[model samples]
Target: MTVLLTIIVVALVGITFWQMSKILKLSQLKNVDTSQVANDKDNDTQGKLMLGFVIFIYVLTIYCFSAYNSFFLPESASKHGVEYDQLMLISLVIIMITQIITQGLLHYFTFKYRGKSTNKALFFADNDKLEFVWTIIPVIVLSALIIYGLFTWSDIMNIDEEDGDPLIIELYAYQFDWRARYGGEDNVLGKANVRFIEGVNTLGVDVSDSYGKDDKIVNELHLPVNRKVIFKMRSQDVLHSAYMPFFRAQMNVVPGMITEFSYTPTKTTEEMRNSEFMVEKVATINDIRREKSKALIAAGDEGLETYEFDYYLLCNKICGASHYNMQMKIVVEPEEDYNAWLKEQQTFGEQMSAQASN
Candidate 1:
């Protein structure tokens, strides 16, 4: 069936090219008035058609913005999320306004000045004042945007180590998996080297460093809601990005150096799951999965299981063949629950000391 479809498509393309060649050869007439080929009547009709198309573009933009906006990630779950959202909204509004004004004038002019045999063409020259006005307007607008962006960028990048008890966590990226390490009471991560990675030292914590002795390692990330969490990110072999869409957080993990990003979790996993937006999202996902499950069943494969809402830490960069599956679960809970879970995890020192006894 695929071969048959390919042959049909190829035949259609060949016919189209052959017809185009014939038309080009036939249209090579010398001293022919170009406007005669496109008559005034045809141009007028085309101008009206273009005007309709402009309206269609406007309608489509409105419809898409109204219907598809809900499909985007729900409100961000970080302390700076509101600021990020406001910045995005401001940019979108500016873009939309520019698009509407330009398109409206373009189509209106096309329709109003459609070709006519009796109409005389007007001689026009460049207007210095008009050019200056256009140039200065954009310069002023862009300057404001640049100034606003600079302040926002500076604030987000500046991390105050002395600020209120910010949890120090390391996000380790590898080929197909992710590992997280928590700094002990000192709230400082020990030095690590890629060479020291072995069976259990997946994150290559320097055992010699006292700061690494009590550092906890975990498969899943757990954070306390409303607590400032600073991630010290590292990569093993290649570049990877730690991206949490919900928190509006992303940072590249370079192989040789550690990168950091800090954000406070404003919502818990359960709170996000139960939110009105997430409830709708889960229902939509389930509906899609149900359709996929039917196709899998027909192919003699196991049907897909129902999906649930959860926060995820995902690799946003294309690092390896298994990059798509490089993800880890994230859970945000109250401070007490997070502390209890943190206590249950084994520390680097305990794990290594136990291995020596074995």
Candidate 2:
């Protein structure tokens, strides 16, 4: 009944608009060009407006690029990230050039050839040379770009097991949080499934599986600098994206299937924090936080904490209401430090046994 009423109301509103349009048309003065065809004056004014609009857009683009340049991400932090950034920069350059040429020609031609009373429109059925020039140019450009992109993609995605004995890890995603599972001494992640989820077994590891007995799970992601790390991703509730912006790494996490991505961290967390770019960014963020903290303190609330630089693993996809808060800190450290940290964490078997004892 509610749907029917909504439909009726929508129909009435539409009909009322139709009637109003008819009345407006009928009410126009007889001398007015009711045919709604463009006249010489109309064309001239519209052409000038188009020209002005194009100029305005160009100025806005320049202003935005200059003013927001500082907000752009700092240099990539992974080995492949350099290549990824290069490809991105090339694509943007090409796009910018194409946009400038096409938009400039479009607006210039619109204004230069705008309709006039004495003008005679030219008609052409076909022009083979023109067609060939337009078609072949785009084909060549697109084909080259596609080929280059494919090669880059292949290089990034090609995970050779023989290469550097990459560390194996699992990134498990859920509605509002993430979990990192490290392959223990065997360096082989065990089998897992959503159905196996139970108390103290959040990631649903196959407890009976020998490979899983030594698996370690933690909330924070830790990577060894200069070491190739392969991440296997899985989602339990809904589709999610595992995004590590600094590494230029992102892969979809789908339920019932394991996705993979790999990258070698080139900088440790402390190294990145100490970099000039990061230092400036951290200072700017802290300044903003301090300003906000003053207001909170005045209202009898504790001031905000000082901002610091840290890499993060974020859920790029909007999975649920709390998706904005779905992130985990990523710490890249020396191989020895990473080993020490991993050694301190309990294995799945130990955790399960302890839970049982309790």
Candidate 3:
């Protein structure tokens, strides 16, 4: 009944609009004027409206940048994140400046020089100087941006192994879930093959391989603060992307191949959670959740829990129906706590040997 009423209301509104349009057309036809048909007032009104919209865009952009700053991810936790953020800011500033100039001029011209039948347009088939100015300016600007981008890419891709003793961790991607294998005290990951994956051997670490003996498989990813983490990524069935927004890290995980990305974690989960901005964000989230939970309870459904800040490893690629659920919790902690947790995990070889004995 409510839906029917809504449909009827919408139909009535549409019909009213149609009738108004028809009446306007008939009125214009009956009262046609030779001098006032295409007046400056109408053109100016339209141009002004467009210019007002542009101004609204500018104001909205500023409002969003300021008002919703806390909703954006907190400060990056990786070493190269500052550089990455600077590059992004440079690109955004360039784009915003160009947009403002072009849009302002476009609307201003429409208002400043409305169409007049007596006026003639200045036409030039070609202007080499003007064309060269526009072309060379963009070329130089784009070339510089491209060169700078290339240097950044090179720096990220070519990591110096000798710079620090990076911890090795393997990220295995499957259809609907993720698993992480940490290279134990040896700091070396053993050979892995998809074919050997069965039951408990989810990551297919070769038990026979000595290095694989100490490989620790875990559901959650744990990283030591202030230490470099080198993730060796792999996929069993389809392509996936490992994305960590807070760390400003993303890398492709291709099937039957290993891809690598390295980053140094600078902060722990507790530190991030305690940050003023994050604390405010959490309060906001919990407030929203409380309202949603009330609605859920009214509908006889489970209520939502309060929110907390935590690092996450999420799959960015759409692999399958369950792709959205492909994620793992990541915890950054002090070296001692991380090592203590690591030691408590069962090694692949130990699990395999125990199963064999059984």
Candidate 4:
């Protein structure tokens, strides 16, 4: 494909230079009309080129959709993500259809109406029917899309307590890493602030608050599959965005303030790893890694390790220099596994007491 594109570009440039040389030569001729106006042959050639370019556009569009379909993200892993994907698919389909119709008509008209000496152009000063059709069609389409999008957004954002007692977790963001603070047992995150940060109190939980005593902070985030998880996001310094791609959830983490996003995990990490799409993606990645490993080995460097599939929590905002490395592993497992893992982590009060004793 690259070679083909390069050849096409070179050919176009060569043709342009050739045409310029001909115009230069014509300009030097004595008593010649050197206005360089397009005649019937030039018009016919340009019309054919316009038709060919439109054909190329359609062909490229079809090729891209067929060839790169596998590169698209797999199915969503959150309950509300299904609706989000549906809305996106609908929007894309509408845009594609509109593009095809509009572009085809535009290029076809250019070719059909190519200038000729015998032809007389028809002029329309105004057409109310045409104006009304174009205006109303877009308004109707845009209105429908906007209304549907609003409903979907409302459903995702309105975190209702009636939708079962959600597992409340605080996602704390710092310069270049993420930390998850779980509300142990009480299922309530306590008030926290940067001023409270000291000793082992990394998340700045107000230790005096009874609700904060049992808050467990950890480097990794884990959630119970099929359970609704509400995340309260906070940033210590600069603004950050907590983005969970697989779950289709993202929210800004502002300094001195907290943002919220909630979603139910529909698939466990293990289940997602075993999915067909994931399996194929992993294999393709490993193949590329193995090829690169050979080069590293030849250069006396360590080979890359094999990769495993896992969901991740990442910073979407370019907060700082190491923004790319600002990510945490997220594990969605069965309820029992999640409970066992949470129980093993030391609470804030315990950590503080241990530090004092030391």
Runs of candidate 1 with Cα error greater than 4 angstroms are 1-37, 294-301
- Best first by TM-score, ranked: 4, 1, 2, 3
Candidate lDDT values, in order: 0.91, 0.94, 0.88, 0.94
Per-residue lDDT of candidate 2, residues 73-146 (tens digit)? 98999999998998889889989999988998999899999999999999999999999999999899889888
lDDT per residue, candidate 1, 1-358, as tens digits? 9999999999999999999999987888986565547888798999999899999999999899899987788988888877888888888899889999999999999999999999998977998999999999999998998899788888878888779989999999999999999987677888888888877888887878898998988999999999999999999999999999999999999999989999999999999999999999899999999999999999999998999998999999998789999999999999999989998999899989888888
Q: Per-residue alpha-carbon lDDT of model 4 for 1-358, expressed as tens digits? A: 9999999999999999999999989778596655689988889999999999999999999999999988888999999999999999999999999999999999999999999999999998999999999999999999999999999999989987667879999999999999999999998888899998988888889987999888899999999999999888899999999999999999999998888899999999999999999999999999999999999999999999999999999999999899999999999999999999999999988998999999
Candidate 3's displacement at residue 345, Å, is 1.6
> What would the TM-scores of all predictions be?
0.88, 0.88, 0.86, 0.91
**Candidate 4: residue pairs that collide:** none
Candidate 2 positional error at 239, Å: 1.8
Badly placed stretches (over 4 Å) of model 4 are 1-33
Candidate 3 lDDT tens digits, 1-358? 9999999999999999999999987778655664757665677688778878878888998999998787677778888887788788888888889888888888778766776666788898999999999899889988998898888878777766577798989999998899999888798899989888887888887767899988999999999999988889999999999999999999999997899999999989999899888888889889999999999999999999888889999999999999999999999999999989999999888889888888
Residue 84's lDDT within candidate 2 is 90
Who wins the TM-score comparison?
A: 4
Higher-scoring candidate on TM-score, 2 or 3: 2
Task: Output the worst ten-in-a-row residue range by lDDT, candidate 1.
Answer: 30-39
Flag regions of model 3 displaced more than 4 Å: 1-42, 299-301
Better of 3 and 4 by TM-score: 4
